[model samples]
Target: MFDIEYLILIFRDEFNYFMMKKVVKLLPLQHRNKDCVAIQFDFNDSIKAAVMKVGAKWSKTHTCFYILNETKLKQRLFLSLKKLNCFVDYSAMPKVDQVKKSVNKEASLPKSHAHALQVFEDYLIGQRKSPSTVHTYRNFLNLFLNYYAKRDLASIDLRSIEIFLEQVMAKRGYSVSSHRQCISALKHFSELNLGMKYDPANLYMPRKDKKLPVVLSSTEIVLILRSTKNLKHRAILGLLYSSGLRIGELLKLKLGDVDLERNTIYVKQSKGRKDRNCSLGQRIRPMLLNYAQTYQPKVFLFEGEEEGKPYNATSIRQFLKRSCQAAGIQKHVTPHTLRHSYATHLLENGVDVRYIQELLGHSRPETTMIYTHVTERKIDEITNPLDSAIQKFNRMDNETPNPLLSRNENK
Candidate 1:
């Protein structure tokens, strides 16, 4: 029954061997390394011998040594000095985390009924609407909603839309075409989202001006064709006159749609997505064949610079503009002018109105009848008031004045 005093030792570094007098404790030699005590201590040989007498096991892991005692054990636990690196200190970190947090907060803030917009977009895509059309419609609705953030869908009445259209016209100076586009987008959105038909009566859409289609004279058409330096331009203008093709129809022509043997061009999925066959004259067939051979376009009849890409309508329109300016023509000529000229020339040549209608792919013959109003011979054939008065004057000059009126007026 003896108590032994022991010293606690802690090593700073294994190689340096710096020992420090950490603590001291007392314990019975017989109780060293005993299982009765739950906690144990470890130290060097001198410290181990003192703790082992008290039934405590030595641990190589700890950097400190412990002394066993009757009530408590004294130990100095050596901890490695942690060197502060880039990540350990908050101030040393980049500003990216703060920016990211701010971004996340703003992004998570809902985009004015995001769920509703997503539903509308999905419905539009499901209906096989064109991607551009879908984007336009979706953006229109988003602008409307974001502009009037306070108003709910139920609160957005016909009157609200009407007022918005007016504001758009007055403030944005949108033309009839643009106004119609806005109305169209909203109408589709309302149909899909609110499950209600948008009545045109509810909206005060601007009246689209009824401008007569510009028709090129046959002489002007010839001049425009002759001004073209490239085979492509010549062939395009020729086809425009030959097939009565709108620029859109011309650009959409695939390689296989042209029939060289029959001298015909197939207009696939035209304006109203209707397909029609148009005659290709034997005259322009050689030009077309030459253009085909020269360009060697793989897919589209008129391949653009981007490999197999089809000729864009806008580019073709610009080409026509440049060609018209070069030709020194005073008339405002468009690709559509060639189409109008084709119809007007046909009508003047005594082609049946119904036949012209069929050739131009007009749904109704009445639409094609406008050419009749503009035909030169049709206008000249009508009896003029001047001609009637001239005949009466001629008869009087040759024979006598009106006897009763002339005699009475003299008296």
Candidate 2:
């Protein structure tokens, strides 16, 4: 009897250990138009409850529990699950380091192409192109070079470039914007390296799809701002809306850029590499002061976990989504939406379009004019033609009086 009881106990212990070691996979999924990490595992009540505690939600469409796929949130979920003795398999998820390594590995070029690419890169850097622009142009040039690796670089003409672009579009499903960038990249390369002077009129570029910017109403904006309880988060969203700073520009802000006395924020080398000053809201002054004291940022206005590093934009986006959800907002809101709302609100308040242009740092007036179409100020003032015509007909009918009604009254 003692031997049989001991064997049963050992078997139960082994079974429990195996159950605790069950694997749960975290998958990349697009849920409700937002990137989310889906937690997939064999159904277990305990694991489900634990995942819920870590803020994972069930998606009917995807048939899995998911959480916002931010770095910090992923780390939190991993740690939380580990504490519950759940094995997490996150190998399927993409990592920034892995992506960088993959890109580096794929960057091989032939000897001739490598020399030309180097020369082109040096030229771009010498011309003071932004890092992103240089990287894009180099990648496009590399693709073109690799396609015609056997042919002489100087021998390539506009016709060959067109064929390459057509093939790429068909294969990769390139959008109009990407197609335009590829053209621009090739044009620059042809002019600089191949000594080709192609006429701009000859290049047939596709028209860009016109889509209006989404603007949140003042009440909704207020709700979103009020819902954000964290001072740092509130300040970030507040600055984005109040000053109309682009996400990149906001992330690049340093303590020295803000001038409390002048009530202005110096935006240095923004889009188009232009520097501009934006008005600082008096309301946000106290908040900024309090945040500065609380956070005690060493370098950038908003630093990440490590000192002197600019705060991760992904973190800002993650918190903004949470704030919008807490505010009961259903719209797809992004950081740029705040900037759009800022411009539209300014336009509705009778601010000159030219002044709005300067504030937004737009190179052309037409770019600022887009806000005019979206502003509700003029739209609200004008009555609909159908409504006006209906009202007039009703008044005329009442005054004329129906003949049948008159006859009936006589009877």
Candidate 3:
């Protein structure tokens, strides 16, 4: 039947007679049309059978078969054509064999949770928060909704909320920031959106644990720097350490931002949309110039494979992990560790804590003071208090002759 179908089509179009035995080209339609995959093919009997099996419909407007741009249909079509050995071009369609799980920090939720999240998102946006903040808020809301899926939203009492938070802390091991976000999401969503009162006295956010930022020792930092032979990687590590720029700030850096002449890197629109000049050491400037000569990054200082695309955060993390292994210093080193070490090392070198705060772009001096606990200044390396006190006591004893007339007797 397919042979007859092909022969009739061949007779109608003379060009079909000279066409290839089997070929399939997937083309994406533009100009405000994205509902179909325009699959153009010249087919043999087996290929025709496969197409018919997948219910490919010929569209006169498109001049090709319109396979609904859908996952199941695409999967079935690909599977049926697998045996034919026909050239299948999937350049137009992203592989949908597995639904790529969204990189949400929260657990995956069902569709019902999305409806609740939409309202929460609208409320956040209405508050004029940044888009990234709103997205993070929405994910936190999703986790809350997932946790209380069985309960009526309005009927959720304070006790249940407490239990849920405990589960997040104990079972999920969510960080303090995550826990805070969750509390904020629930409070706003319930009080503002659902018209339910969220009594903070009943369910209070946990106090943040007094944990020190993990910092690499100065020697370990040098080892990691020396181990990373790639010029781009070294510059990235060095710039991060020298300037104390956040990972996001580092990735967003433009070539024009690095001012080696003034020995400053202009950090633009950092965390709070605030700009500041971070000091770049004379040491890393030569390396930066060499890297510029080699890589020739057009726009962003740290570019990915394609031009103008910022190098991904994952790449930086991977580079740090690999560098740590090679340097034989493993303390769960992340890219942020480099920034932490930079701040702490600066503090250790007698740079004022206030100046370190400014360099780190920290909003609060208290936040910067956390590094002081970890840094061992020259003052800290002085003689022990016990030894100093003992020496002073012995010198006094040597000077004194008797309790009644000690001063003159010693002279």
Q: What Cα-based lDDT does every candidate model obtain?
A: 0.66, 0.84, 0.76
For residues 230-257, write the lDDT of model 1, one tens digit per residue: 8898899899998898887888899999
Regions of candidate 2 where Cα sits further than 4 Å from its true position: 1-23, 26-77, 90-101, 144-164, 194-203, 402-411
Off by over 4 Å in 1: 1-110, 127-136, 193-201, 400-411
Model 3, span 271-361: residue lDDT tens: 8878999998988989999999999999999899889999978668767777898999959788888889999999888899999888888
Lowest lDDT 10-mer window, candidate 3?
A: 98-107
Clash count list over all predictions? 11, 0, 0
Please list all clashing residue pairs in model 2, or write none if there are none.
none
- Name the top TM-score candidate: 2
Worst 10 residues of 2 by lDDT: 402-411
What's the ranking of the predictions by lDDT, best on top? 2, 3, 1
lDDT (Cα, 0-100) at 302 in candidate 2: 87
Please identify which of the two predictions, 2 or 3, would achieve the higher TM-score against the true structure.
2
Q: Candidate 2 lDDT, tens digit per residue, 321-345?
A: 8899899999889999999999999
- In candidate 3, clashing pairs total 0
